[model samples]
Target: MADKVVPIKEQKLMDVKLGQLPSWLAARDYSAQGIFLGFKAGYDRFFNKYINVKNAGIGGFAMLMTGYVILSYTWSYSHLKTERIRKYH
Candidate 1:
């Protein structure tokens, strides 16, 4: 008789530990963790693809600064528009 190898997906599903917790809670936690990790992995892939500069630290800092500038501009623009409308009223 020959042994067949089980797929990793089945192996992982079989390895869930339901210690001191209800079956539904354990499954829900496992599913939520999986989704969070999957989203982080996808975001990391996209960031690495676009932000591959010479220095990793500098690249990260640049991205942070860019995001800050964008948010600042949007905030100031919205505030100014609201102030203009208030003055007219």
Candidate 2:
């Protein structure tokens, strides 16, 4: 009796989609539990969705390039201003 292992359910041909996610989210608005669930959803997006097997390489590369561009512009803003001043001088 103790050796039984339960397998996860596989997708079937006619799967039924459940409740409206938006309505459910709206129902939990501004409460502590809602905030916790929001954090969990954010973590799931960043960790699970972003780093998944199918598009992980492309998605990660795109994200890295975007971050690099934004940070590069931000970090070099002062230098760019100096160059602009030097050019106009």
Candidate 3:
């Protein structure tokens, strides 16, 4: 029986054209301007649409309570003084 040799396909690297990117990403002001716009949009949506006075008050109170508990525990640990015992001959 004769054996048949099959050729393997070679992978090729694709060239990225500038036009392939979105208009915002392809613009020269993409880095800082785009990031600031995105951050502003997110901040606006979060504070305006999602957050309110009641939610902010509750969140702040919870955070304050947590901080107080942590501070109390740390203060107690930091105030404990070590005692040494001495033996007399």
Candidate 4:
């Protein structure tokens, strides 16, 4: 029979040891999925883990609002800077 494969997070929760604290924290998944989609992995994990069906009214709204404000400000600031440069040159 084939042995069951454990997920990284679940394996950490189930079998981590005090002596292996340093190594455990330093360990990373080097699988193709983890390596190729590192940024996407982290992004998906964060949204899946923290921004779920529950609290969509509170935390989700807050996160969306904050992201909107930040991106809008950044775009406006960059546009203004570019306009200033265009005026000079």
What are the lDDT scores of the predictions, listed in order?
0.64, 0.63, 0.53, 0.70
For model 1, residues 23-86, the per-residue Cα lDDT tens digits are 5344443578788986797678757765665555666668768989999989799777877766
- Native-vs-model 2 lDDT? 0.63
Clashing pairs in 4: none
Query: lDDT, candidate 1, residue 47?
Result: 78
- Candidate 4 residue-wise lDDT, 1-89, digit = tens: 99787644445534866776666656766788878787796678768766766655567658868989999988799677877766543
Give one digit per residue, the lDDT tens place, for model 2 in 1-89: 59544322322213323544444444454889868987897767776766765656677658868989999999999988888766552
TM-score to native of every candidate shown: 0.31, 0.38, 0.28, 0.38
Q: Which candidate comes out best when scored by lDDT?
A: 4
> Can you give the lDDT of residue 47 in candidate 2?
67
Which of the two, 2 or 3, has more TM-score? 2
Which of candidates 1 and 4 reaches a greater lDDT?
4
Model 4, which residues run further than 4 Å from truth? 1-36, 80-89
The deviation in Å at residue 54 for candidate 3 is: 8.7
Ranking by lDDT: 4, 1, 2, 3
Candidate 3 structure lDDT: 0.53
- In model 3, the runs with Cα more than 4 Å from the true position are 1-29, 52-89
Which runs in model 1 stand beyond 4 Å of their true positions?
A: 1-38, 46-57, 83-89
Measured with C-alpha atoms, the lDDT of residue 62 in candidate 2 is 85
